[model samples]
Target: MTNSAKPRARAADKRRRLATEAARVLHEQGVERTTLADIARAADVPVGNVYYYFKTKDELVLAALSEHSAHLDELTGRLDQLPDPHDRLKALIEAWISQRETAARYGCPTGTLAVELDKRADGILDTEAGTAIRRLLQWAEEQFRALGLPDPDDLALTLVSGYQGMSLLTNALRDPDIMTRQGAHLLRWLDSLKDTDPAA
Candidate 1:
């Protein structure tokens, strides 16, 4: 590669790494507590270099949000591979349950971030952070609609809310096992909805 191309590529790599570390720090510490220096330290990039990619902390936060959105899109793509909508929904629940230990320690990253950002009076991070949850709800709603549910919207809301509620409880109780138990209950609930519609 040419010298100019090499530096540009390295800069891109550094920015990507910074965004990833910023997302992790934001999830663990919340936006108010996370600083660009923290992300720089986490990414092992010089603190000054961060300015080359992001002019302010908020920009870094947005970058992290973008990274998170891409992650959700990737997850949705993977879930779409399952032909059965029910199985797809179950896979989503199982995926969340599998992260029980992390949720118990740090809460649900997307949920917690959304709540935290929403609580901000300035509304700066509101739209971007909110998109994370909104995207999940939309994906769940699509699955429910595909299942031929009469009220797919409501079912989608319930599924997302239920998962968020369980995550909140798991974090509050400091018990990862709570997620496992709740996951089983959710699965049973999903099964109960099966065959509710003859046309489905």
Candidate 2:
């Protein structure tokens, strides 16, 4: 390839790596607590180099939020591959529960980020940070729709809210079992919904 193309490719790779590392740092530490230095250290770059990629911490966080969105898409895309709608829904719960330990340690990645960003004084970051949660809820709604559930909208809220509530408790209580237990109940609730669905 041309020298100019090589430099551009390397720059893009470095930016992506920084954003990914920033997302992880933000997840492990809250947005308020994470610093550009923390992200740079995690990405193994000089702290000054962070400004070359992101002029402000807010810009870096926006990149991190974008990175988080990509990750959620990758995860939910896999869940959508399951043939059965109910199975797909169940798989979503299983995936969250699989991260119970991490959630217990650092709170749900999306949930915590949503909560923190919602507190911004200007409010735009709130909407940006909510993207991951919205993606999850919308995807769940689609799965319920495929199940022929009449209340896909309400059911989607119920499903996501339950997980969010359980995430809070799991973190507050510092018990991963809270998520596991709630996930079981959620799974059974999904099964019972099959009974209510005439299509089932």
Candidate 3:
């Protein structure tokens, strides 16, 4: 409501929009093929304005990485709301199922981006580049721990790996239904773990 606060809010909104668009573009085009102009066009901001917010392509990409991390956090935070850890874990697989089409088209947003960054010699890969999936894995680990599973760490690895692996296969085969089937399979596995006691 205040005059100064209004401008600050507007600036923050503008930057968030820019970063989100950049992330979408990078997801569609991969990191090396995408340009600031491509991102600016997607965001409906001028290329010159992009330079005003980010001095280099790498800076913009890092902003996109932040955008992805924020998205991952929001997703896991929602999973945290479920009353049952088994439900929460199953919901994680559901989230991936919901985006199966997009994965079939562009791959898993977090996984593909992390893979691209890892393969790149560009320094953006060094700076919080793969944290989105890493953070997701950590979140899953927490959920497994909450479930009192004997092998929380190993279970978390299975969950995250299944997601990434299915994402890759779905994308490679252009078969969105692969994720649907994978979700069903993971749900059954989670059910089998519901009664496990970590201390036993």
TM-score of each: 0.96, 0.97, 0.92
Clashes of each: 0, 0, 0
How well does candidate 2 score on lDDT at residue 75? Answer: 86
RMSD of each: 1.2, 1.0, 2.0
* Pairs with steric clashes in candidate 1: none
Candidate 3, 45-159: lDDT as tens digits: 8788888789989888889889889888898789888897778888878888999999999998878888888876755664476677778778888888877777778888898
Candidate 2's residue-wise lDDT over 67-116, tens digit each? 98999899888987888989999999999899899989888877898899
Candidate 3 residue pairs in backbone clash = none
TM-score of 2: 0.97
lDDT against true structure, model 2: 0.91
CA shift of 5, model 2, Å: 2.0
Better of 2 and 3 by lDDT: 2
Residue 62 in candidate 2 has what lDDT?
A: 90
Winner on lDDT between 1 and 3 is 1
Q: What number of backbone clashes does candidate 2 have, counting pairs of residues 3 or more apart or in separate chains? A: 0
Query: Of the candidates numbered 1 and 2, which has the greater TM-score value?
Result: 2
Measured by TM-score, the strongest candidate is 2
